[model samples]
Target: MPHEGEATPRISKVQDRGWAWVVLVATVLVQALTLGFPSCVGVFFKDLQYDFRASNSETSWFPSIMTAVLHAGGCESILVERFGCRVTVMLGGLLSGVGMVASAFSKSISQLYITAGFITGLGSCFSFQAGVTVLGYYFIRRRALANALASTGVSIGLTLWPLISQYLLDEMGWRNTFLIFGGVMLNCCVCGAVMRPVPDKPPGPTLKSCPEQSREGACLSNGSTSCHEEPLHPSKRAACFQTLQKYLAFDIFCKNKGYQIYTIGVSWMVIGFVLPLIYLVPYATLNGVEEHKAALLISIIGFINIFMRPMAGLLSGLSIFTGRRIYLFSMAAMLSGLSNLICAISSEYSVLVFYCIVYSVSMSVIGALIFQVLMDVVEMDRFSSALGLFTILESITILIGPPLAGLLVDLLGHYRYVFYASSFFMISAALFMGLSFCTMEAKNKLKETNKPPPETPSKGKYTEVPTELDHDRNGPPTVVYVTSI
Candidate 1:
């Protein structure tokens, strides 16, 4: 449409507004489906134990394995980069649906471990990574707010799924409940359909000099020579391998000190982070609370968590909270630890209810900002790799956390020591994170103080003066000169 000499105009796209919200909605739904069901595993604990005739620690492995695989399986981020978000998520939905259906037919604990724990967890990993990664592509300025809003889906699912799972377990037994849940999980395909990939700019031509070609064609009539333009396309198999390598890169651990500190601190924190969620219902039942009432306690935490996540997100995005989110996160972790310690000492329903409310506040604040803080520390291109490695490390804790708590319950004959252990781990993690934050700040201040000041121009060096200034002079045809030194 334009002359040969005219440069083409490229349209600039605005981010963090408009269609980005749609992507956020789809991400929320994906998270709700993936994380919500796992959070409700506690509701099925008694049913599973009764059916399998297993001990408490043995039964706890179902959720523990599922949680561990879900986190460690973040390696699925490679599939997101290679196959694209929609395909990877759709595949995940299919696997999840099939796994749930298979779990319904599971005759023993081992079968459940294979079907429910490994398959469903693997599928959830794919869907979760794709959903989380897509948000970074669509938002920049409002990234924290978007992540907060999207993460609330976890709270919503946590709140509602327990009630739904409880009703189903009450009416139709565990097997039929899993069958119906399989059908419910098929809806993840629909959510995947909504996850349209954000378009990327096409790669520009790459020029490479060819000395041999230049020498052979130096005498062209136009006196201009052609250079080779490398093709952008690669074989699909090679591309897939490259994608895997990109997401699995481990150099980030060695290159980023802040990220290293965050990873270690979070790994320690996660050892206790999920134990309370998995054991709370059982603990409540041990202390004279009814089963239904115990389930309601989780719902209460979820209800409060829903509001707290968005509030934390908005607060973290404000200027006052800028550059200080890590401190907020540390405080939240400390409060969570303190709440668990209080729970260890209390048996009254009213006291436990208050503890749940406080736990919700801390959980909301921590969950909402955890990834955002990681993004702040790592380069954007390396985020997926960083998240994958972090998840893999955290999975070690997730895998062991619940089972260890269950072991304590078995030996001590009470859940109080479990709570005490959780409180200790969380508090230690918080202190580590706080130390890392202080160290980073001190380094930044030192850098600022050591930076060299700008050099001033030397005096008595003549510089050109503007002609308009000479015309402005009215008396004695005054000649003016500017001097620097």
Candidate 2:
């Protein structure tokens, strides 16, 4: 007899159709709700400043903490592994709702730091990671398209959130607006409701599969009752270590050069990537642009990205971009840096508006390809762990990006310098990643050409987990890659 959820096979055969579409839609909504809020923080920046009598650095802490906490990759990986994505997402939604509702009553920025920044951010972290993880599991043939589509939620969230925040602030002030945000955040639970788990590999005969483990009392005890819950201190430590190994990509960090380069490059890029989102509206407003128009600058980014991001995704899905997508992503980051530099030239209303459009064009590609590139670096089974580590590293940069910019503003007393700093970081990071990846590709190609052919033919199927990618019906054979336990 089959074990629970094992009667059916891995969803690969059934992926990209039927219930996968439902999961996709839910994932999109979840992504929008979580990722979109960070950028929207700009719309409320002034009111927060005026009401709390806080400095730019103090205000920066709120979003820095929120966005940082939201990328809790390590924590999220453990949660997704233990309880699965569904429970983790609903739990995040509930916590996020509480955070927002509590923020509405906060008497000080410090309290908002706890409630709005940490709690809500932690909630979003759970929802975003789990949603993205499930979406990956559900599609392979259309993986790029699905990711591109899901990523649009970020743009959608970006577009609608600012307008919503501004309108709500106008009608009922920030407190009531936050109260409403709490309600909006709760919808994550509804999205989580539909993310059914994909089936895992069917169980093998217990004794036949693991004689050594049984002998060591790992899965059995004295040929009687199981001893899964009770173990000695050392055994517990060993078990914990194994779980970390299996569920976290600590090993990948050390072994995979591609993963290491990707993680580091992305992490470094984030420091510059996040500054403009937090500071753009304030910079525009400070330079004498009207409040509503300043907000519109950000909205323009979302609007342009709505179109550009999908196109980027579709382009990535093609065979031509099979191995070249990373270069495209790098170019986008470089373009973003160039656009930030342009902002330093002038803060005129029309000039800032032009800057928004150009920045949006670059970021659309970045947003679509960022996580998708990570997916390319690591196989699916290891993706959760890889992403966990990736996010944790990037979150550090994100947590500090705004505050560092705020410090620059505080010290130099000019917003233009933030753009300069942003440009420096982005340009340098793009160059580093682009060059590093290009070198790796060239080395791999040279190695392939120099290697000799096999001396003898052998026939054996791969024992490790294999992902059956249905790229084409009559094209080449299925491409197989090893999946870690």
Candidate 3:
């Protein structure tokens, strides 16, 4: 319980202009250079296939490991907590740059997995996640818009990278193209340099008080934050969740049900989410499309999303959709599954173009909202840990997803089945998430409806009726107050 004279605490953030805008730009570019690279990886498919003499499943492992570790930044939260975003971001850039440079010189598929998959993904995790952490803190009034704009970097990266990779692959082949890519990846250092620290003092949003968090599933809301403003001395604290929270932050799973649901659902969703992007170019090539033209099919998706992402973000931020973020996301996920069925139907340029545009719109919404939704689930400032943990859970499926898709390709000897598999995963994930959230809401409402009314207190003190043991000894009604447990 709080002392009578203490004030409520605010989580500081929101410069909303000037340096905040610069940081936002940096966040976008960091995402572009790191997260966006994977989508264009398909451009190197044929060359890598020819050089390595690998089957589809073997080839698929490279990108699978790259993307899996990209989401598997288990240590990112600790880095951000101890070192701050700027240093973490810069360090990531350096690691990724080195990884790419090493990948250029690699002689085996296994070596590329180490250099490109693990190391580069590690570095990207650092730069991308840290930049986003700062971005979340910097805006409240325009969070949706800022996130939308920030996410366009992925679209932009996707749009430009495949085209650039194609041109480079033609001129210099995959190895030298990777050498240039290493240099390009070093640009993350510049973006990281822009991730200024979030302030600890507020002109920011106040933490809602304990009284409002009466719902059964509410996370971390039952607390007197101001009462515990001073830290507990180490000797006074027991070795428990507090100790775990200080180090691993895994205690958050126990605290936040939304985080649990979102993380698990998205993990399943990712099993199919990236398959379409990975196989799209190959599918087109096999269907009599020119190699360059097939690459353009990917480029078209990126281009449409460049426009679609911000619009989705803007539409979501409107008054009518203010509380509808999850519903919107679920709808988009379903759209992603349904749209892939179009590619299964035909690979003609026009049909593929139509598919790309639809996929782009769906992809745009998912990308724009992905992190935005995470930030909403966890408490502010603790985003780094929440996200770090999320990536760890998410990375498991990411690692297996593409290779699983490739195995399907190998077994069936047809690319269309990959889309069919993708459709099932995406659509099922959407239903699970949409229904789960709706069910949680209904349960909360029922709990609220049936809750007993609070008894009025007498003479400005909270009163609890004495139990059997206390009845004989008590002179007056017992006083109790809510505690930050």
Candidate 4:
């Protein structure tokens, strides 16, 4: 006597439970490792320049090309769907590990580009996206908390990598650092292995288990009279191609207003997002701050971001603020934009640090909620497509942002223009989001006011009798229908 819609025993046995924390740890670890290496690119830039006899632009290819592949290699979502989490991440880990090791042996600038840029970047794309997809599948009620926790890996990586790179540079130099870091990334394979795919639901019973011929009175299977019965019609299965055609959609973005605004805002935000962080060191040095102080600013930014991400998640999950993340994201961006403007005017180290604090919090809010905000706006079923499309869009921005900032610096011979330009872009993105959500809210209110009240369903039987109704109640509207049992 199984309850309707209750998972069958066999199916339930395969469904993993209480392993979500394990999944979270693995996701966090891989993300921390993957992001840690890339964020420390500046440390190796000068060393690379001397070794390869490359120009600033030539050296820039190492990070720019790597980031381009990281963003533009939008294969993670598709692979996640096809190969599942465990394999996709494991493969990514292997590629990334091998790429770093190969980097240690490079002789030319082209070698670094091919190894670090295309090879390592592809690896990161797989590992990063697989980790995110795993989090989404394993947790729903605490999804934001999980995302916040995992995203701390980025800050932690940023914090840790610089110190590690500095130590390695002081001891064994750049080549050996790649050797050391490459060895470190091998742990990602272990992380990937732990991210086992959730098992599928067991198939329904065969004809022999169907009670259709066993008990005539109980076999009223096609009717609603009995709770134990199931519908007797054959359960049709769509062809694989047909199923794919139905589920895979690109036009969903155009149809969804929330997604359109979110995508555009996120794209713009990303276009200038990493620019300030990229210049923090150079900006400080230009104003006569010591190299050590410039490096510590990055550490401070990471320290604050590590704490902010989880806190924002917890706040977003609160009962009072359910389904309103767009508002929070908008405010954070505005504050961050203001901080960038402040940094532009300041020559004092203290004022610069103040701006870093503000920037850290805002950046964390943007990173922590960007994907989650998408999930809230787009239905869960369509998240795969949305993220896939989003990766393609954001990749272009990631490829452009830092270099654009550097270009501004090169053109103006000062850091001020770069900060002002980036701040303007960020502020513009924030305003777009604010107006978009406000418009959405207004539309909802308008629809509520104009729509006719639903007709109440009939009870057993009744003559019409109108009762006094209070339309001013704050709860959902009520419509009363007369009936007699």
Candidate 5:
């Protein structure tokens, strides 16, 4: 029994199935609604450009800002902690819907930037962070598989949204399409609703001062208390600053070496990671493929990815990839780089199809393992902070990568150079991560070799034993002695 004021330690309830799988489904929907729409922005590229009379580089800012905000939005973890995943995601849904609805009324590119880029992007960040963070709350052993399964929402959205968006653009025009997309985005509220909050560990018994009872005699009301207990109100300014610090998670970079290495590698990789995706349709059309056919290529990538992501997740979770998921991620990055090189050289439709297949495989493998690797390196309690820092760092590349790729396209009067640049950056990122992995392995090996040997049960003693048993009529068994120093 606990003492008068003592509390029982609450074990976290980690359910691998039941409500956990439901959370996975909700997370998948949230991801589809939040991430899927941005990926299909490629289908809107031409319309956006023509309507606003913007150059490729200028128009690229829409997706760039959106992507940047999506990543930078990881800071929504503070909201998740304060408001809970359900409310945060609901707020995100409302903002995204409102942004899209407002975007339909925009007469200029700048308005689109505010409505589509900043508002929708901010909403996406909230839903994404909440969905991902809540996912980690539900499963431990099966987290990789769950993440993979949830990630398929992106592929599904990518596969379907392009077709839908293209059709909508043809019939309704960009303005009406934005209006409808806003409605579709509102479904995220449903997703948020389904995200039943996973119960956190209950707080220990806390003593509150009682005027009648002495401090020593103060009694705990219950064996457990609410973890959500509010502190006595503090100064408003101090509270505001504390909230900002909690949300920003700025200290993670200073404290975690492995996380820092991973973040840097991811940041570098993002500089080119999605460049091909952004430019694929344009590149294909430049090569004389029909617009519809080029759009189909994205669907192809999505279709292949749907299967590939789950497979990668399941395989990585197996014992074979234990302690070496980062190596798998590195290999995937290298393969993606090679795929980009293939895309750079290939103009034929069939060859581009092959490139899509290869790219899909690489993308799926990397996506499935990336978060798993991060989670493996960071403690569960710190995942939100680490992820927030990672997103903010990666957002720098996301914001600039597309515009720079577009600039290359404009300068060269071709798309091949952009692909080449992407390939180079991706390969560079792979090499950097590979080098980091090798260094980590070497350090681990050195530690192993330098580890002190186990103490012997009998210190400084030598023991003798028979090497073999000899059964003979006239001879006793012979013995052999072994000594340890």
Candidate 6:
């Protein structure tokens, strides 16, 4: 028997199959639209450089800034949770669409930076976070597969966007390409509108105080206790406002060794991660591979990634594997690093292509699993806040990683060293994650083997509970209160 709150397979009835399919398709479509722009930047790089007359250094800033803003939007998760998914996402879509439209009118590099990188990135941040968060709540047992399926939108968008952007660039020009894509992005609003809220389990009732009741007595809600208090007075609500005195909650991120492991491993791995993808085509072209052949490499990578993500999810969910998904992910990361290292040494283009295929599979699987690991470390309720803190802290790396890779390429005058360096980073990440996996295994085993760990003193805190006999019975449920001393 599955333990309470342990994940159980929720096989849908045959009659609901059609509705499930609809949800799956709708979710995946929204993710595809949201991710298209960032994933297709490489295709636009050469054109943007030519049009703007920007140096490689400057052009790199465009994508870097865009990625930075996207991560920075993690801070908005508090708002997303408060406002509900539909409204937040629809607003994001509008913002993104407008940003694209603004980008189309840019006449200078700075203008392009502001519109394409900043504004569009902000919109994308909202859409991506909200979509992923919603997916987490909607499905439990199938979350891995659902997330994988949804994430494939990146690859699909990558596939179609590049081809479309290329055609538009040749036929109509970059400005017109942005205009058309901007119109296409307006559909994100429709996507947002379709994302219905996921239902939450009703919590047990809580009372703020029972002053007249004996300490050990249970006070029933049906007037079992007749003591009356002064009529409840409505308290003034604090007006929401933004402030600049932001502080990094380093303690939250640092206190959990698992989160530390995840953060370090991901940051280290990603530093070398995007470098290869970003430069894959250029690397091939420099090696004398034909242009079309080089482009096809990315398509092949994307296709393989499309399959690998769900496969990782499915594999991770299996009970037969001792449920050691993190360990498996560690191995995959190591292999990806090794593949890159080999590719760096290979002179034959076919060998390079083979390496690309292997790396693509590993990278995609790791990407999908990484967030799952994060969810495990931080429960769903705290996920948004943890992710926000992670983003703000990890933004430093996200901002620096690519430009540093570009610098290495410029200095070394080749990308082979980049691969070697990236491999080292990935190896370091793998080793750290392997440690985390071991510690996690030991902890879970201790928890299961009838041994009780020592207890720690509690911190006084309170949480809001939505109280209604049935979760769906009323409008938004009323907030019940609790006290901890």
Q: What TM-score would every model get versus the actual structure?
A: 0.80, 0.83, 0.78, 0.77, 0.81, 0.75
Q: Residue 8 of model 5: what lDDT?
A: 20
Q: Give a tens-digit lDDT track for model 1, residues 1-485.
A: 23111211111142456667887888788778888778778888878988998777888888888888877754564465456667777788888888889999999988998898888888877777666666655565555456667787788888888788878888998899999888887777787777665543222223243333324322111111233333369898987676555655467677667778888999999889898888888788888988788888888888898898878877877777666777888999999999998888987789889999999999988887787677666665566567667777888888888888888888888988888999999999999998877876676566557986336311111111121223221111111110000
lDDT of 3 by residue, 1-485 (tens): 23211212322222456678898888888888988898778988767877888888888999999888777765765576557678889999999999999999988888889998899989988887677666645554455456667777877888888889888988988999999989988999998877655433211224433233333322211110221233436554464555445434476666666667777889899899989889999898888998889888888988888898778766766667654577788899999999999989887889999999999889888876776556555554455456656667778888999888888888999999999999999999999988887787676556657986446422111111221223222111111110000
Q: What are the runs in model 3 whose C-alpha is more than 4 Å off?
A: 1-14, 136-145, 194-258, 375-385, 447-485
Deviation in angstroms for 184 in model 2?
1.2
Predict model 3's lDDT versus the native. 0.72
Clashes per prediction?
4, 0, 0, 1, 0, 0
Scored by CA lDDT, what does every candidate get? 0.72, 0.77, 0.72, 0.67, 0.72, 0.62
Q: Which wins on TM-score, candidate 1 or candidate 5?
A: 5
Error of 6 at 80 (Å): 2.0
Expressed as tens digits, the lDDT of each residue in 27-120 for candidate 2 is: 8898789988888898888789889998888889999999989876667756765577788888989989999999999999999999999999
Local lDDT at 1 for model 5:
26
Model 4 over residues 1-485: C-alpha lDDT tens digits? Answer: 34323433422332224777888889888878876556677666657878998665566667766776776534665565456778888888889889999999999989998887788888977887677667655554455456667777878887877667766876898889998877888788899898765532222355343444333322211111111334455334545443443344356566767777888898888766766766666677668986567667777887887888777766766767566778888888888888888989986899999988888888777776676576667654555556667667777777777667656665666878777888888899999988977887776656657986337411211111222233222111121110000
Query: Which candidate should be chosen as best, given lDDT against the real structure?
Result: 2
Pitting candidate 1 against candidate 2, the one with the higher TM-score is: 2
- State the weakest 10-residue window (summed lDDT) of model 1: 476-485
Ranking by TM-score: 2, 5, 1, 3, 4, 6
Q: Candidate 5, which ten residues in sequence have the lowest lDDT sum?
A: 476-485
Number of the top candidate by TM-score? 2
lDDT of 6 at 84: 65
Any runs in candidate 4 off by more than 4 Å, and if so which? 1-20, 49-58, 71-74, 136-145, 205-249, 447-485
